[model samples]
Target: MISDAPFASPDSEPTIRVQDKTLLGFRRSIDNIDAALIHILAERFRITKAVGEYKARTDLPPADPKREEEQITRLRQLAAESDLDPEFGEKFLRFVIDEVIRHHETARQSE
Candidate 1:
């Protein structure tokens, strides 16, 4: 079975166990970014939850392919402009969109 963790392994070592000051500083920054990402995702989900409910109430489809495509295109352009990989941006957005669709499906089922 696949783990739900953002970073998961059957066996892994944490840098803290080695006690390298440089690595420790880098990890601290990474940890802060990870926490921020989680908070941003939480807020995104909260809004998506409200959107899912509205869609269900209005008898709209769970997945909006047109809008999804538009977002992908927009984000890809933004990613390129920001010197980030457009492909990675597309993949990330697709993952989030998939999760949102899953939530929308569950909301529909519950309603």
Candidate 2:
């Protein structure tokens, strides 16, 4: 009988053992991807922070609706091409944009 546990027991079938290894491999890949995503997000925030400082120095507005709209559209198209959900892409971009705008506003206030 097949066990419902995540990992194969010592007496489990060879196929189940192989499946366990395969599952581990997939999880490792996912972990690596998650790590890369975090690094990329960190880099993006760093650049956005610099942009906020620059905008504050130059007396520019914190939020650019036109640019945000363009980004949303572009991201949606990219998501569709990548077989991802456009709405999810837009939501992610909006969340990041909102955080960036908040940072910019704080920078402006300090200027």
Candidate 3:
């Protein structure tokens, strides 16, 4: 059974009722989704790393403002359609874009 209190004191041990299995089920689903997100991010970074290598070899700019803006626009629209916050989607995409650009710049310097 989950605690009636929404939050436990930081120093207190969490109270759980073993008879209440619903919370466990929900937590398992959350864990699975978290794992999937990690795998997806890993794959995305692998592809972006290859793109960075290609851009480095071809002397292309590490950062593309036009492309980034287009992606943010698209992501925001998609997030809105999915009932998510557009601003959050844009922020998340911007963070990833910044990291990718950093990797590209590092690759370029090493070339």
Point to the candidate with the largest lDDT: 2
| Weakest ten-residue segment in model 2 by summed lDDT | 12-21
Each model's lDDT comes to 0.89, 0.91, 0.90
**What is residue 82's positional error in candidate 2, in angstroms?**
0.5
lDDT tens per residue, model 2, 1-111: 444466656795633433466777998999999999999999999999999999999999999999999999999999999999999999999999999999999999999
Residue-level lDDT of model 3, residues 1-111, one tens digit each, is: 256666666888876754457978988899999999999999999999999999999999999999888989999999999999999999888898899999999999999
Taking the tens digit of each residue's C-alpha lDDT, what string does model 1 give over 14-91?
223345568679989999999999999999999999999998898899999999999999999999999999999999
Candidate 2: segments with Cα more than 4 A from true spot:
1-19
- Stretches of candidate 3 off by over 4 Å are 1-19
Prediction 3 global C-alpha lDDT: 0.90
Q: Model 3 TM-score?
A: 0.83
Arranged by TM-score with the best first, the candidates are: 3, 2, 1
